[model samples]
Target: MATFQIEGGHQLKGEITPQGAKNEALQILCAVLLTDEEVHISNVPDIRDVNKLIEILGNLGVKIQKLGKGNYSFKSDELNLEYLESQQFKDEGSSLRGSIMIVGPLLGRFGKGYIPRPGGDKIGRRRLDTHFGGFIKLGADFRYNKEERFYGVEAPKGLKGADMLLEEASVTGTANIIMAAVLAKGKTTIYNAACEPYIQQLCKMMVAMGANINGIGSNLLHIEGVDKLSGCDHSVLPDMIEIGSWIGLAAMTKSELTIKNVSWNDLGIIPETFRKLGITVEKRKDDIYIPAHTNGYEVASFIDGSIMNISDAPWPGFTPDLLSIMLVVATQARGSVLIHQKMFESRLFFVDKLIDMGAKIILCDPHRATVIGHDFQSQLKATTMTSPDIRAGISLLIAALSAKGTSTIHNIEQIDRGYENIDTRLRAIGAKITRFD
Candidate 1:
């Protein structure tokens, strides 16, 4: 395992480009299994999850070649779909939740899909029953192997579209069923789907590949099942989640940064939410950059001119993934704000570390916390800490980077699951951080 030893209180200054979206890349990579053609993807993030997914795909007989760093060409056009039992599949599949995406594509094209229990952030009980239920609605049968902890679903007649009302608008669940719907027979309507930017990109990509899809931005998706799909080249969108992290990092460290190639359109209310926390965001053409030397941020009032709590909800709302970073950033803001993480129950539990850093936070319950900002600042007091999850791990890095002294973050592999080359990139921006095995 690798740990990050960081010297704090230095500004993370300079201009840097954000990597492609991890969430989007995961889904798009699996879409490769839908067809047997050359599908080139650019701006790929060099991270553990993507590499793991590549290993899984390679095990599935998908040929992948690296043209250069951050660029690759992959072809599953002639994939030996029956060879799904490669050992690499189980090894790599065990470490990433994105591994579950293969189930839909493999089921649609090869008539069967086998996947082991995928791993991700242990923030709480991450359920796959929603995903498997979606698969059942799309005409596939699932049986669990208790010993192996893997699932095998076979769809010999190919998937036939059916009306599905998701139990919850699970983001991964929405992506899984959407992929399966593309090659199914007849029209498929999915209501209460998670229409986050990643899901929209999946639909748009499928549309480009001859899959008929409607309602790109809404929670209700209409996909007309097509017999086949061809390959196309696409550049993954810049990660807005990373953009949020940088925004918080810049504010917390009192630094200036210009994040180039930022997808402003996809940012939605992200910039506004950061602005609410009193961070200054400057937009230039395609880039949404942050200004230098931020003072303490302030709580923004609501539309009815009343104080409002910042919380996560479905799409077109605050993203639950960024809630942890937002809460940490709030500790540096001028006033108090409630970070309501409605999606996951235990995500708010990590705030105790912030309290240890002299942050005033009250964990009301599993889903909510009240944070009073700017009133407390302490010497980050060089401590050895274990990373809990991807979002929280990065947030800890930001906190440590803003502290007065040295901080060593153990198990940086959790951070790597999402952020790409984080230490190197932070160093480029004047942060003193080094990684060691």
Candidate 2:
């Protein structure tokens, strides 16, 4: 495996562009399976998970062409349906959670879809029931092959849309059902759907491809089944999670950094959440300029004068993905705050590694933690660590960059799965991180 050796205590300066959204890319890339026409996509992040999904598409006979860096054209004119039944296909599809999305488009166009148990971060129990339940509700037969450990959805008479009240507002599940319903025979209404920017972008892309979708940014979605869909060009929004990470890094290391082309309208409550931690973020057109937090920052209390609590919720609320970064920034702030990671149970386990670096953190339970900041008076001492997941990996990298001395982080493949060329990009802004095999 590869590792990152970072020399901490350096102040980063200059501008950095966020990578294209990884979550959106997963959905958009799989949506290509819904049409046989050519779809040109730009601003694609060259990351491990996305590339793996592209490879799976190629293996399934989708004709792919490289247009340039962060650009590609995909045409699913001919698909190898027989490959879906093979062991090689099962092994490939099982490697990433995004693979589950392929089922919807395949079931929509070809009347059948199959997937192995998808793999992803071991942060919590990510159930596939939300995805399969939607399929079963939409006039499809759902079955799990116990021997092969695979899930399959088949509609021999073709899919017919029906009203569905999602058990949870699961992002991937919402996308999967929408894709399946687009080509279904009747009207489909989805209540309690996930309305995050990722889902919004997917809806826009499908609309561009001629799918009749209403309510792009709300909990209720209505899709009218169409005869077929065409293809269109799309560019993903900047990675909001990466932008949040940069904000945390600048505050923790007291650096001056500008994040470029961040879709401000789509950022939701990310900037305000960071500001609650006392970081100064200036909006320069479409970019965010974070000044050096040298004088130190403090957590802001509520109007009632109660202790501040930063927690994750659905969209328009704090994102669960950024709670890790916020937790790291709180380590160097001037007050205490409680981080409640309600969506995932075990994401807070990485705090143990941060405590080894001299951070004052109390792991109250599996879902919550209380962090007592030292206000830069006590610098974290660098040590060897391992990355837990994509978000936690970047959070630990930010902590390592702000600490004193050198730190080695192993299993950075987790980091590369989301952030594109992270070390090289951070190096351009004056960070001292090197990658080695």
Candidate 3:
């Protein structure tokens, strides 16, 4: 276990280039299995989750060669289609939610895929019903063992494409089915598919590898099955979650920081959402330069001319993962605003720490909270805290960094799972922080 110690009340300054998308990187890595030739990937984030996926891929008979900084090439040559049983695969695969994607590719290519129920952040009910729904759609049969808490699927008859509509736009479910459909017998029409930047990246990479996919940016996707796919070069997009994290960190600490090479096209309504909080943003082409200062918190009214709370739904809306960070930023704003987390019930429970810091907030229920911004001018005192979830853990770090005295953040492994050398990056930007094991 590691801990981060921070001396609060210092402005974080300087410029940081964003890392590759974590969500996208995992899908891209799994897609490498679809091809036997070498697939070159650049700008991959060297985070725990991505590294764990690589280890799992290696055990799957994928040869991985790290070419240089943020660059790697994978070759799934002589992929052992036989049943895989490795302790490393299970250990690393169990740590992240993204590992569920291996099921589709393995079943499609190798005829059988086995994995345990995954363990990530304990935010809420992250069910695999949608994923299983996708597997069943692709002609795979599922079996589970309650004693081992493991799941396995077999698609020996081979996958035949079918028209499928996801009840919800699950990112992993879309990725899973898309990977499975690449080798299916017929055309697959996936309506209500998740078209987030990550899913789009996977689709683009699949196309480069000769997968015929129509409707790249729309929720309706058409995939024409191909005999085989060959590897191609692809780069992961800059992580939107990291961009949002930087935005919240800058606003909370009142620091002048520039996030470079941010994919501005994918940032639909993201800038507007932050602007509603009174954070001034200077957009120069693709780069977003955030100047120091918060202009008081403002509650966003709906376009329907009604009082509406900013919350998380699916993609094209505010992400559920970032609502925790946004709630922490609201602690220093000027007015009151409601934070609704429609996807998860337990996501907003982290406000109790900010509540202890003299901020005015009321937890309405499991899925909603009313944050009464105190315009926290007086400093927040330091405390010993343990991180609970990935987004909430980083939010706690921001709150601790902006507080009055020194704060010790324990259980930082959760934060490190997503952030790339986060303490080192923050230190480069004038944050007084250090990590200890």
Clashes of each: 2, 0, 1
Off by over 4 Å in 1: 86-88, 302-308, 375-381
Instruction: State candidate 1's TM-score.
Output: 0.95
Cα-based TM-score, every candidate: 0.95, 0.99, 0.96
RMSD of each: 1.8, 0.7, 1.6
TM-score of 3: 0.96
lDDT of 3 by residue, 1-437 (tens): 89999999998888987899888999999999887899999999989888988887887788999999889999998776443556656666778788899887776676678888898888889888888888888888999888767888888888888999999899998999899888888999999998888999999999999999999888999999888998899999998888998998899898989999998998777888888888877798888999988444455567886644788877788888788888888888877778899998888887888777666778989998988776766556677788998899999999998988999989999998888999989999999999999
Q: Which candidate should be chosen as best, given lDDT against the real structure?
A: 2
* Displacement of the residue 384 alpha carbon in candidate 3, Å: 1.4
Error of 1 at 201 (Å): 1.3
For all candidates in order, the CA lDDT equals 0.85, 0.95, 0.85
Residue 330 in candidate 3, Cα distance off native in Å: 0.5
Q: Pick the candidate with the highest TM-score.
A: 2
Residue pairs clashing, model 2: none
In lDDT terms, how accurate is model 2? 0.95
